[model samples]
Target chain A: MRRHILTYLLFAVVTFVTWSQDTTAVSTGRHITPVRPSTNVVKQPGRDVSPELIEQYISGDTLAAERKAREDSIRRSYPRYPMMTSLWLGVNFIDPILMAMGQDYASVDVHATLNMWNRVQPTVEVGMGWGKTTPEGMNFTYRAKPSPYVKLGANYNFLFKSTPDHQAFVGLRAGFSTFKYDVDAHYSNSYWQEQTDFTLRGEGSHAWWGEVVAGLKVKIARQWSLGWTARWHHLFSCKDSEHSQAWYIPGYGPRGRALAFTVSAYYTLPLSLDRWPRKDSNYSAIR
Target chain B: MPLAWFYGSGTTKQVTVGNVTVYAIGAPGDTVLVNNQSVNELSLPLRVSTDRTQWCLTFMTTDSLFVTDTLTLAYRPIEYFASVECGAMYVFDLQQVTSTHNVIDSVLVTQPHVTNVEQVNLRIYVPTAQQ
Candidate 1:
């Protein structure tokens, strides 16, 4: 089906270019283009031969295919994405929504990425998070005020050669945060013959972690886009607290948990729009 | 967990605390966990309410010296989920340990995190009679 479509496309382009003087609409089926009276027609000697046959063609689009082939050819010869492309500022919605829904822990983060050649994106994220709750069926009340965290990473887009309307990327990030919280605990020590109740205030802790991310982003408007990323994070190291371990590390989520997720919307800022290779370039389109 | 006591000055042979009464400092109305018993090893309950625990070891020496020594432990009380049936509990992560060098010379926290595993969490060192 595709081959037939391409054949029709080639036919239409040939006919259109050859008969610019004719004012007839191009149709799908094979129809001889009418002679404009200025062109010469020759007949073959064979009995069953077509006399000056004019072919016609039609299809969805070979424009993209031809452009891709040309781009691929040029990429094979010249450098790909040789210039700085754009910068994207992203806002996360999943965490904020979950936080509003009374989740135990959540964050609001904004990130920025430098889209280099639509191939690699180096990014940085900064956010403030809070965790305030006593888990159901637990006796202690844990509280942490809004704490700040930062993450630095880069993403490699799998569809680098394709249009920049969407991306499928896998990336890595190094995250860090330092914060303080208070845990109010009330536990009965039967052996000690007492009911203990007190609060440990100003408990400080710092943590470092790494995340492996895989996500997809699609442009919705000219400058607006939405994306979702699933992240697998591991606590690399945390400053051990003698009173208690960190229940939550702002951006990284729960202390011992490994999996996390986020949905984000991006506002793109074009640093420099990439112009495709022009006809004057070394790998210009062939006639 | 039971913290094993040892004679720390040099002898490899383990020693026992003769006629020692052990009680938490914050216990109400003279409540004694160990009442004048020969103690080689004992399990001490840490308070979940606070980060510091102090225990008074009243040693009845052979010469009738009723010497008193203090054992202080500083730790982080971590909330732990033991099991569904047992519910949540507290575990101690030992941070700092010290003892007045009267009869008790020093304190050694062997395995810091106090959990359900029945291992030595601390080694309370005392001078030998030969010293």
Candidate 2:
């Protein structure tokens, strides 16, 4: 009976061991999910940029770039000084005519000019001039008086951002006058000197004159400015004659005179912009 | 821009332009014409004058295109007479011409029933003797 029982136990043990080994083999045999060599991590959306970057775009960097571009362009252009369309007023020298015969008197001129370097300026000037005819002992009257002249011209300046002081300039004048000749001038009740004095009876003739001028221009202040000008003029053809015999005229004998001269000065003024207008590069008002 | 030479005062003389001399001869206040063209029709003032030694005259143009007349008379004591005998005489004097606002090179003279006369030479008229 004992031997039969031992055999039963052994059989049971063997059956159990076989079953366990079968389960282990099944477990190692198959894998349902396939293995991949790389990780599958996802990237998150950007949400943490620094505030300074945003502020720089809004405040200065873009503006600075635009400014730099403009500066470079200006540096590449040619420099130019534009004409100033202004009225000028300043002091000047004048040469006067003393003879009706057109000879004998070449007068010294001293006067002031106004509206010198400003736009739409009005000016008035007074001057003392003296001229002489040859052969001084004749019985003709000769002298220069304080004469006033009106002049109109154009003034300009250059304001190339690339240059210094914005060069200033003015030019080409058209002038009108009541300039006249003194036929017979007497001094201190003395008989007029022949070379200095003369005989002609007529009122001064109205004349039209023209000139070309150039000058340096500068701004003294934000609202004030200054200029130094040089000008040349032609005292065109005028008509006159020697009156009576022994008129005692010298240099010209008995011919009409033509006078021409130059004027130079420094223009100064108080600063005021009450009526001045802001204008474009070409002097036209900006719309 | 042109360079202009202007003679201000002197005796008026007839001058030619492009080689042509024109003249109109008549008593004072007589209407004259060149090629049947009336001179007064253009309305430029003509003037006459006399100096101690010669006669001076000039013609003026209106509007810078015409001429001015400044005539100088010879200072002959005989010319001072109120009336004179009838005759024609010619006298010449040194003449200088000028312009105010235009180029003056030639002169034009209009005669009664005659074609317009033009001259380039400077000439002045003075009778040898007053009648």
Candidate 3:
């Protein structure tokens, strides 16, 4: 009876051990749900992003600091200085060509300008102009001698932020000229049986005018440039003689409002190149 | 309309008078006798003849003593298309001008070429006493 009882106890222990192992397996299985095969799902490629780079992009303070650094670098490239002067010798090609066509006009000018900040250019121009016109079948012959004139003005470049080699600008000028003119008119009256010839002279007559100018300048080489300007001139006042009005006012062109055109080649003499700050790599992108 | 401008000598200002009469030389019946005429202000619309190359204008003064003066203008008729709406008009370029010495002492062609632009092309010099 004792052996039978021992056998029963060992069998019961074995059954209990099997039952506990099964329960443990079932509990572990209950934690995991069955995954079905999804035909409609798609997988996208993942980008490898570093934590440091992400932090830098999200931070506003980092962006502001970088922008300030770039601005400071650009400001250091173009330093402010005193007057930077440049002298230019120019000519009006149109006037001389028109003179050949019997329109009778010619002008030559010299210019000096102070370039400030590569933005504002204050200029002074001195020129001599002369013209004569005798209309066909007219008894009068009008003549104007070469006379010197002066203009003071400033030009504002629209492309100030770009390279200094090229400029598109609009300018204003106040001009004055003192000139001499002569008019000879001859008339014959058949009915009166009389003939008369009269000569009128206007000496040392002064004229004042204003001009609105638009021009383009392109650099052909180092210290050399080609430019053309169109001007609309308005006469303010003109001194007239007793017998006749001044037919042409040297720099002013005609007696009234006139349009003038000029094409010029410039030889720039940079007066203070070493004194002014040089352009740096930042503006090299525009060049 | 085709028009031409005339002015008195010495100035471009309009000269006002009490009475004046204008007549075409060949067509004596066609006359415009204006009372209180403004000489410089008048924009004369010239009549061109197909048969003749010259136009004659006679001016009569209605003062205490009636005085007359004649002006002859020789021109070349130019036919050009001014615009679509304007169709065509005759533009005259004065070749020669002659005036009778009476009230008008002399005449000068300041601008021989005339266009639609309003300008003083002829400067008529009247006698000092008449002026």
Candidates' chain A TM-scores = 0.69, 0.38, 0.67
lDDT (10s digit) by residue, model 3, range A159-277: 77655567799999999999886666664433223355666555458989999999998889998899999999899888754344566777777665488888878776665667655
**Highest DockQ against the true fold, candidate:** 1
Name the runs in model 1 displaced over 4 angstroms: A1-79, A277-287, B1-42, B46-118, B122-131
Candidate 2's error at A129, in angstroms?
4.5
- Over A1-287, each residue of candidate 1 has an lDDT whose tens digit, in order, gives 99999999999999888796454445444588687976677643332222221111123355654555455555555435535677889988798788778878889899999888888999999999888877677667888878999999999988776556688999999999999888787767676665656677888888889999999999998889999999999998887565566677899987767899999999987765546434345433332
**Candidate with better lDDT, 2 vs 3:** 3
Give residue A200's lDDT in candidate 2 (0 to 100).
41
Q: How many backbone clashes does candidate 3 have?
A: 0
How far off is residue A262 in model 1, in Å? 0.8
- List interface RMSDs for the candidates, in order: 5.2, 17.4, 14.6
Clashing residue pairs in candidate 3 (N, C-alpha, C atoms within 3 angstroms): none
The fnat score for candidate 2 comes to 0.00
CAPRI grade, predicted model 2 = incorrect
Runs in model 3 deviating more than 4 A are A1-87, A202-204, A271-287, B1-131
